[model samples]
Target: MNDFTPSRRSFLAGSAAAGASLVIGLNAKGALAAGHDGALVPNPFVKIAPDGTVTVIIKHFEMGQGTTTGLATLVAEEMDADWDALQIEFAPADASKYANTLFGMQGTGGSTAMANSYMQYRQAGAAARAMLMEAASLEWAVRASEITIDKGVVRHGDVSAGFGELVGKVKETAEPPSEPILKEPKDFKLIGQDLLPRKDTPAKTDGTAIFAMDVAPEGAIYAVMARAPRFGGTVASLDDSAALEVPGVSAVKETPKGVVVYATDTWAAMQGRDALSIEWDFSNAEGRSTEEMEAEYAAALDGDGPVARDDAGVAEALETGTAVEAEFDFPFLAHAPMETMNCVVQAKDGKVHIWDGSQFPTVTQMAVGAVTGVGPENTSIETVYAGGSFGRRANMDSDYHVEAAMAAIALGTDQPVKLVWTREDDVRGGYYRPMVKHRVKMAVGADGKLAAWQSDVASKSIFTGTPMEEMIVHDGVDHSTVEGVSDTQYAIPAMKVSVRNMETPVPVLWWRSVGHSHSGYAMEVAMDMAAEAAGADPVAFREELLAGSPRLLGVLKLAAEKAGWGNDLPDGWGRGVAVHPSFNSYVAQVAEVSTDADGRVKLERIVAAVDCGVAVNPDVIRAQVEGAIGYGLSHAMRQKITLDSGEVVQSNFPDYEPLRINDMPKIEVHIVASAEAPTGIGEPGLPPAAPAVANAIFAATGKRIMRLPMVDAGVEFA
Candidate 1:
């Protein structure tokens, strides 16, 4: 055997205890976590047990996105371990080791889970495999270079042993290589395979998956909050005598956000909250209706605000050419995640423990710690499975979590409080996708070529008062406000894109694809209009402008070919195509629609093509694309969060309905295969769905519906 000596990692030197397991972390200088059975406590990503179970610690949240399965594939592929013997768990809130490299924070959003952790998990798995091979080399008196691991078994010629058998000696004699070699794409066994089922699917299917609502501690109490009816409204007076008299009610406490009612269970707490009476003060609240807000936004577009992108000679060029003007008004949209917002908070002995399906755990920990007088380091967070977030749970204010912590503090911190928001609360809740208005004026020269393009966008900034403002906002212009327009890959010459950030008392958040959600719609619809003005086919016009973006063009061509863009459909049906790139992924979708005599649109079918660089899990990518199309179509067809006299108009799904089962069209997703690094797939599929459907409606009927929730524009779905 070769005498191999490894330089001990400083972080793991004195922390290692005599044990029969190995733990490898993503960072060489990370802190030690408490390990099971006095094993090496250092590192936080990969752990090998004495029983041969390879546990991968996932730092991202999985909300029906298959993040767990995608992340675990990296480790299993590099370690050459048996996929069936592997398990996964969520990492605790520790930014030092678990921070996303893209955001410098421990959070999951923007579909950046796989993009950020791909190399980290691979390195972790390689390090563990290196240590195991060295351990087996020493135990069997074989050369480390000659030992090979295949499907969880270590072998040297005829001598063979399982990873569990050699793990006991890894900590005693073997050392992890500082730079472990990784497998190439050609040698990968599980990275691109679709047969390896998702690890979380079985639990979710068998009713064994534990969501935030399933958490029940021994002395846990249920809490429900009754907040003001309007955004920025405050509690002026409160009477809790009737609430206290309700059955199973224990106490009602008033906090800054709202009044919290604690009871023995969820039903009792909801009943108690309903029984309480509170007078709201709307002196500084938002009293403008949707129409008033729309008017103000429309007025803001009349003048230019902060410049996101300014090109010279655009004004002089527009003086002589024909201008095609288009305007769009989008209403505030609710996330309306299925589970609502719920969390379990426990505070005792000046420390706090929070349990939730946290999309932003670091922010939640800091917010809860500040509320309970506990430092962030002392606050512990346990992330569970989320039903759905879409962008609701990752609040900068940590709204629901902070409320739960305050309730625990007010109720004497002896018991845990499980705070739940009813569907009504969720519908009326503040943080919504901001209402936006876009005005695009394109000047075409006599030669039928695009000469000048000026786009003015107005919307409430989602990052103005949040922690992300400093990173995302630039030069007094929130980059998110003009993302899709300012960063368009279309070859438009002499373009000027400006953004006007409007002030609003109502809170706004980053919906699925952030700014691309509305910007993509405005840009795509305007492109279609410009194509008509130029007397060219929509697909041909896009092809002429998209020469600079190969990925975008690739998907557009693929989608058009798959959908038979130029082929004649049924006599009444018309087709439209839209392409958008968001979160580093490019997606194109084509919709087939037929309009009734009254201009009601009936979506016949949809075909989507996505180029997300590399497909980590093809199944997951296809599923996400399908879901995104459905979600996007649902809002575009008939969903809006309107406001009247400062009160939200829609209370439940009836008014703001999701797409009915029978309403969903047949969807087909095609993925482009490439050798580049993998990108996000969760959100890119959404930006094109709405615009494609809108364009299809226009194609079927010669009328253009510029506003959102087409029903309001007198364009209903049959």
Candidate 2:
């Protein structure tokens, strides 16, 4: 990634040498800052070289979301920058320069990369194009209006100049206009166009993508941390004599939390780690056993908790009417990204450099700097393409990266180290989606209309003790546990949603779609139960309840139509539908399933419809939907993290199963055409998927499954 951004600011072009190339830096507001020498410090987001090469510095990590290419399209569309001239690079860690507008930090999560940076990146390109026009106006002595730029060229009557030739006019001395003209959607050239291939795909296919594990800085040593078997357990004491004698092993250092083995390669490091033995300590173990935690949640559900939403008539309606109640138990789920946690760190002269596939670069920089005693400003972080994140990489604790920095500090600067976690370690690592239980009770009237709904969610709070506790949690209630239920789309007459934020020593972090992961399954499947009791078609029932939200209704209708809702199927096969809105996007899903004679539920197909507004790249949209389906299905089927005596029982894929590619159901995605601004597409497709399958299983066998790892209810593929 040749670091240059001449588009967002006045870009300087030159060779790699600091003295050879012109340098400029800018602040987060797109204004230039002064370098150490008092010269102009450039804050470059895009670079246009004299050779006509356009490079976009991606602020968000490409965590298999296609955001890298999607973002590039926004810039190219607005600037009329030639797609053939485009390239991409990871932005350096500088929160003041690349803070995600949604979070005021340099990171990518909450499915906000495209949503938050949508207008920001567009403005960058629009401003860059304006800067070029200002330069062309001066170079040709023509009014800025007379200077028409199109397809990488600026033309004034017969006098025309290619962007490469005119870009130099925006020299190190040229100043960009205070205000830049922007293009309307109708005038878009590349946005919403699907012909262009994803910029990341070619590199990924060619095996040239730069993932954190692939980064091997000069003289880099591989490290494997022998982390505590129990959450929050420390290193206690280590006997590394055997580890140090291992072949290629350099050092066995103790970090604040773990023992790090430094070796020539990952295998050597692992071997060294395996050879080490230590005094085991569980006296400081933070978590109780999974059984005890589940009992606590169950008790909390039966007791009282914080009320997130309440409406009149709930008690009166539900007390007098026939009702259906179900208790759903959802286990804690590990993120289990295909690429395990890894970070490369090097420290020198009170300055630190970090290379990681981090979802939070600003946090990573600060955390790593703080641990290394270098401070945030002295840390340089390069966000690399992540193999897979879901939500594992975006931790409030900065867990993995911080441990890497600790190891680097122990190794004593100058020894660049790559901290790697094997799949076993990652699976056993904490910070899973909180262990939760949902007790939902819904009542319907004789008129076939919904009368009342009440939901109680008991779970470990993802925000409880973290730095974000005060900002989000209120009055003993955590929104993450009740998000989908509190703001449910159903138009019930009375509703009450509450959460019991059961304190658990088990670490918890936001998984894909956060609260919607469990709440979606609970609410959507419970609606199906209500529909069954009312003897109404599921789709029609949802339609009646969603009169206030036409967008969600529209998606539901679309999915139903695409799936042939009323069509007959073979014996033992049934169709089930579900709809939910989260992350500002509406999604509806239809699952086709069949129960085998042996009582295994096999999902045949899924029809998903989404209204995410303007589709920047339709291919990426479909990919996201399909990927979300796979991920959601994995959890719904049989993915769970269990602990015995405060230790994770599941170690790797063998036990903590991920949905295999061969087992994935056929998914058909339909994107609703809309001219509105784009919303989130990343996690919106997941929430509706699980309940759709669960509902389909219910339709097939008349069984009401109200628990996660629906396989627990005897569901699986042949």
Candidate 3:
């Protein structure tokens, strides 16, 4: 038998002792979290057990972004570990154990998982590999440089030993080297491979993967709550006698936001919540509907706002030509992840334990601890796999998690409670992306070039009253509202951008692409309109204007070529295009659209080109591009969350719906080759999707879709 094959059966029988696992860190730059006693904590991300299994504990939560596979590939490539024997585990709640290398806190968001973990995880593998080689060197009594590893086997001349055999020797080593070697990308066997199926796919598909909602702790009780329909409204009074009388229904308590119904099971809790009668007091909130907000925003734009930027010579440029103006209106958006929002908390003996799929579990731990009076140090969070979370689970204040903890505290801590938000509740829930309106006036020179520009953005400040207020909000302006506009890609002689930060009772937050969700649509569609006004081809106009940005220009050319931008379409069909840069990645998209005999719009195809730098997994990249396309199209086509008389108007899927399969377009993704470090891939796909389709519609039928949910513009749906 070969040296490697003979150790297989023997390795399978060995197991690691609980205390023998090797613990190491990459560096002091947020890698090895120091404890209260200034001692090294045990956070073994790459652990080689005696049983020949390699376990990697990750800090970030995976919500369909393929971090599970992408991260595993990074470590395995560096360690030369056996891919078949690799396994993944979620890190437990301990700030000193698994802090994010970038944030110093145990949380995940901002598409920063791969960006931050890329070096740390790989270095961890290299350290482990070096430790194993040192063990093999001692056994063979040879220089460590003489030992080489291949497929989990360490070889020195005629002597050979598997990693499982050397792990015991590794345990005997006093300490690992502070600096370990990392592999060059050219030697990678798994990091860039797209065909390697993810390790979690089979379990997720076979229904064995346990999501947070699927978890059932011992003696768990179910909970359902009724939130005030109106923003800033409160429950004045509630009668829960009828709820208490129901079978399996145990108790009902009044939380700050609503009344929660606790029962023995989920069904009973839901039924009990339905039986309760509550009265809401919304005296302080009024005129919060979409119409009222639009009027307020328009007025704010007419007056002076907080000027974000102002360049000299704008007045002279405008004096040379009359102004061409355009306005774009955007409404509130809901995150609406498929699995909805749910949290399970156990508060007993002055300590709290939580099990949830939170993108920011550290925040959840801190929030629950504070609410339960247990202290952050006393709280423990067990992170579980999430179904999906665009950005809701990582709210600035952990709103949903705090509410769940409050309900659990009401249940006396001894009985664990699983607080759940139903589909209706989640849809009508607060924390939608703030409604916004953009107004821009431009002046062009005689040469058909942009001479002067002025832009005004008005919306509720996402950071004004949140925990991030002190850090982000400045001089009465929220930079997030005008990020894409203030940092316009096109060159102009004179430029100015301003924001009118308004206050509304409605809760708002950062959506999938945050500020770019609105700013990208406004800038892209506005550019298309400007091109048409100049009687120049949209592609040609943008190319000439964006000469300064080569990355964006390259994608524009590539996307146009792939989509046959200048080719004639079937009569009545039209093509539209848009390109944008956000989250340090550049993307360009072109959409082909046509109307059927019934005047219904049909999205035929979408061609997207991206430059996210060094593609980690081409399959995941394509999937994210396509998924974002669908998501953006759904919102632009019909999805909206409206309010009337201070109460939410939409209830469920039938009202606030997703794009059906038939409505989704055939998408082709092309990735530009480059050796640059990887940037974000999750949100950049969505920003340009709506504008590309909208611009195309304008090209086909001289109807400009200034407002979103093209339905509002009286456009018929396919």
Candidate 3: where is the Cα deviation over 4 Å?
1-43
* 1-718: candidate 1 lDDT, tens digit per residue: 1111112231122122212122234334323322475343224678777777788888898888889999899888988989888889998887766776676667899989988788877887887788778778778888889988889998899899887776667554334565789998999889878667998999999999999989999899999999889998889999999999999999999887789999999999999988998999999999999889889998988976999998987897788788899999888999988888999999988889998999987677667777777867678899999999889998777888888988888788668999999888988975799999999889888888788899999999998766567678988789999988998989998899998899878989999898999999999999999888888899999998999899999999999999999998776678989999998889999999987777567888899999987787888888999999988888888889999998899989999899999779899999998888889888999999999988888888877778998888888688
Best by lDDT: 1
lDDT per residue as tens, model 2, 1-718: 1111112111111111222211122423424422222322223566666665667878888989988899899878877888876888888776656777666567798888888777777776776777777778888898988878777887888988776676556655555443456788889878877657889988899998889888988899889989788886766678999999999999988777688899999999999999999876767676678788888888888888889989999998898777988899999999998888998888888788888887887666666766777766788877788888888998766888788888887887577889999999988875789888999888889898789999988887887766567667988888888988988878888999888877655678999999999999999988998898898999999999999899999999999999999999999997889898989999999999977888777789999999998898889999999999999999998899988888899999889988987768899999999987899999999999999988888888888787778777766666
Tell how far residue 642 is off in model 1, in angstroms.
Answer: 0.6
Task: Output the lDDT of residue 175, model 1.
Answer: 46
Q: In TM-score terms, which candidate is top?
A: 1
lDDT per model vs. reference: 0.84, 0.81, 0.79
Model 1 CA deviation exceeding 4 Å by range: 1-35, 38-42, 596-599
Q: How many residue pairs clash in each candidate?
A: 0, 10, 0
Alpha-carbon deviation at 577 in model 1, angstroms: 0.6
Candidate 3's residue-wise lDDT over 348-449, tens digit each? 888888888868765566666667778667888888889888888877567777777888876666877898888888888747888999998788777777
Name the lDDT value of residue 270 in candidate 2.
Answer: 96
Q: What overall lDDT, based on C-alpha atoms, would model 2 receive against the true structure? A: 0.81
